[model samples]
Target: MSHARRSVLVPSVMAFGFAFLYVPILAMIGYSFNNSRLVTVWDSANSPTLKWYSALWRNQQVLDAAWLSFRIALLNATGAAILGTLAGLVLARFGRFRGRTLFTALTTAPLVMPEVITGLSLLLLFVAMEQTIGWPAGRGVTTLTIAHITFSLSYVAVIVQSRLAGFDLSLEEAAMDLGARPVTVFLRITLPLIAPAIVSGWLLAFTLSWDDLVISQFVAGPGSSTLPMVIFSKVRLGVTPDINALATLMVLTVAVGVVIATVLLRRQERRRERDLRLAAGAD
Candidate 1:
C-alpha cells in the first residue's frame, strides 16, 4: 500500500509541475484567438477570431521593430560564431601562451556576468568611444548588435570548445603529414567536422540576441527599438490580444525551427554512421 501511494504521489507531483509551467503558456496561446481586445478577458458573447493575426501584419511599428531585431540577430549571430570559433580554436588547440589565462577568463566572463551590469558597462564604453573617436555617431542598431555579439560570443565559444574537446587531433596531424598546411587542414578537416557546432552556436546566439531586452534597452536609441522592447512597452500599458498573437507566432516559429534542427541533426547522425561503417569495412 505504501509503495502504491508513493508511485501515485510521484506521478501526481509531476503532473502538477507540468501544469504549473505550461498552463499559463497554453492559456496565452488560447487567448490569442480571443475576439476580445483585452487579452485577459474571454467573452462568451463573441466567438474566436483571427483578427489579431491580421492586425499584426498591419501594425507598422511592430513590423519595423521585428525587422530591426531580425537584422541585428542575424548579424550578431554571424559575428559571434566567427569570433567564438576562433577563440575556441585557440583555447582547444593552442598550447599555453602569453595572456592565455586572461583570454580564457575574458571569453567566459560574460556567461556568468549579470545582464544589467554588462549592459551598463557596455553603454559606458560606447559613450566613451564616441567621445574619443567621434565614431558610432550615437546609440542605435550598430551598438545594439555589437552588445549582443559581445555577450553572445561567450556562449558560442563554450559550445565550440566543448565540441572540439572530443575531436580527434590525429586527423589534422594526418592532413599535415600529407603536406597540407595548417590553414589547409583547418579549412578542410577541422572546419567541416565542427560545422555542426558552429551552426548550433549561431542559432543559440541568434536566439539570445532576439530575446534580449535588457541589453538592447541600454544600447538602442531612437528608431532602433526591437520586438522585445515593443512588446514590453505594450505590456506596460496593459496586455493586448495583439501582443498575445505576436507571442504565439513567435512560439510557433521557434517550435518549427527546433523541429527542423532536430531533423537535420538526425540526418547528419545517420550520414556519420554510414561513413563510419564504410571506413570500418575498408579497414
Candidate 2:
C-alpha cells in the first residue's frame, strides 16, 4: 500500500479498535446518569440525575455483597502476595533443588487450568477436608477467600519470578558479604527492590478475585454472594440504572488505581535510576 493510504488505514483501524473496546463502557457510563427508568432510553427532558447513585447508596443487598467481595479480595491479595513471593524466591534462587520441576509445575498449573476444573477440584477438596477433619464447618466467605487465594497466588508467583529473573544479585551478595544475614539482606535489600512487582501482583490478584464468578459459584455458600455474583443475578433480571451507576463507580475506582500504580511505579523507577547513577559516580 502507498504511505498515505497506509497511514489512513492505520489510524482508521486504531480508531475502530478503540471504539470497539471502549464504546460499551462509555455507553454504560452515559446510561448511569440517565433519568429514565429504562436503562437505554435518554430522558433528555429531565436527564442526568444522581437518582441511581443515591439509590445505589441505599441498596442494602448491593452494599453487603460489595463489602463481602472487598474483604475476600483483600484477603486473597495479601495471602497470595506473601505465598507467591516466597514461592518466587524459592524458584528463582533455590538453584534446581530436588523436586524443583514438580514444584514449579504445581505453582504455575493454575494459570493454564480451566476455572471450571479448579472450582470443581477445590469444592471436592473442601468437602473431603470438612468430612474428615470436621473443619471449616460449611462453605461461605472463608471458603470463597481460600478458593480465590488458591488460584490467585499463581499469578503473583509468575510476576514475582519474572521480576527476580533479571534482578541485580550483586546488591544481595554485597549485603551478605558485609556480614548481613540472609533474612536481613532480603528484608532490607531484595524486598525493597521488588516492591513494585509485588504491588502489581497484589492488584492483579485482587482484580481476579473481585471479578470471579464461576469459581465463586461452586465454593460459595447460599449467603456468601459476592459483588460479581449479585451483579450477574441482577443483570439476568434486567439492566437497571443503579447497576450502571455501580459499574461506573467501579470503573472510576479501577481507573484511579491504575493511575496511582503507574505513578508509584514511575517514582520507584526514577529513584532506582538515581541511586544507580550516584553509585556509579562514587565508584
Candidate 3:
C-alpha cells in the first residue's frame, strides 16, 4: 500500500476499534440518568433524570456488597504483595536451590490455570479443611479473601520478578560492604528500588479481587456477596437504571484514580530529572 493510504487506513481502523470497544460503555453511562422504570427504553420525555443515581445511594444491599468487596480487596492486595514479593525474591536471588523448578512452577501455576478449575479446587480444599479440622466452619469472607489472594499472588510475583530482573544488584552489595545487615540493606536499598513494582502489584491484586465473580461465587457464603456478585445477580433479573448508575459511578471513581496517579507520577518523574541534571552540573 502507498504510505499515504496506509496512514489514513491505519488511523481509520484504530478509530473504529476504539469506538467499537468504548461505545457500549459510553451508552451505559448515558442510560444511567434515564428516569424511566424500564432501563432499555430511553424515553426523552421522562429520561435523563438523576432518579436512579439517588436511588442507588439508598440501596443497602449494594452498599454492603461494595464495602465487603473493598475490604476483601484491600486485605487480599496486602497479603498477596507480601507473599508474592517473598516468593519472587527467592526465585530471583537464590539460584539453583533444591526444588527451585517445582517452586517456580507452583508460584506461576495460577496464572495459566482456568478460573473454574481454580475455584472448584479451592472449594474442595475448604470443604476438606472444614471437615477435618472444624476450623473455618463455613465459606465466608475469609475464605473468599484467601481464594483471591491465591490467584492474585501469582500476578504479584510475576510483576515483582520482572522488576527484580532489571534491578542493579550493585546497590545492595555496596550497602552490605558498608557493614549493613542483609535485612537492613533490603529495607533501605532493595525495597526502595522495588517500591513501584510492589505498589503496582498491590493495585493489580486489588483490581483482580474487586472484579472476581466465579471464584468468589464458589467460596462466598450467604449474606457475604461481593459487589461483582451483586451486580451479576441484578443483571440476570434484567437491566436496571440503578445498576447502570452504580457502574457509571465505579467508572468515574477508577478514572479519577488514574488521573491522580498519572499526575503524581509525572511530577515525580520531573523532580527526578531535575535532581539528576543538578547532580550532573555539580559534578
Best by lDDT: 2
lDDT of 2 by residue, 20-92 (tens): 9999999999999999998878999887899999999899999999999999999999999999999988888
| TM-score of each model, in listed order | 0.92, 0.94, 0.91
Q: Candidate 1 at 85: error in angstroms?
A: 1.0
Give the Cα-based TM-score of candidate 3 against the true structure.
0.91
Q: Candidate 3's residue-wise lDDT over 1-283, tens digit each?
A: 4787669888999999999999999999999988777877888997779988889789999999999999999999999999989988887777798899999999999999999999999999999999999967898889999999999999988888888888768878889999999999989987876777788789889989999999999999988999999999989989888899999998888778768876876687578669879997999
Residues 1-283, candidate 1, lDDT per residue (tens digit)? 7688669889999999999998988898999999987666786578488889999999999999999999999999999999999998998999899999999999999999998999999999999999999878899988998999999999989989998997879889999999999999999999988888898899999999999999899989988999999999999988789998999999889888978997997799689879989998999
Can you tell me which runs of candidate 3 are displaced by over 4 Å? 1-5, 273-283
Query: What's the lDDT for residue 280 in model 1?
Result: 83
Q: How close is candidate 2 to the true structure, as a TM-score?
A: 0.94
Off by over 4 Å in 2: 1-11
- Clashes (N, CA, C under 3 Å) per candidate: 0, 0, 0
Candidate 3 backbone overlaps, count: 0
**Which candidate would rank higher by TM-score, 2 or 3?**
2
lDDT of residue 221 for candidate 1? 92
In the order shown, the candidates' Cα RMSDs to the true structure are 2.5, 2.0, 2.2
Error of 2 at 133 (Å): 0.8
Worst 10-residue lDDT window, candidate 3: 264-273
Task: Give the candidates in order of TM-score, highest first.
Answer: 2, 1, 3
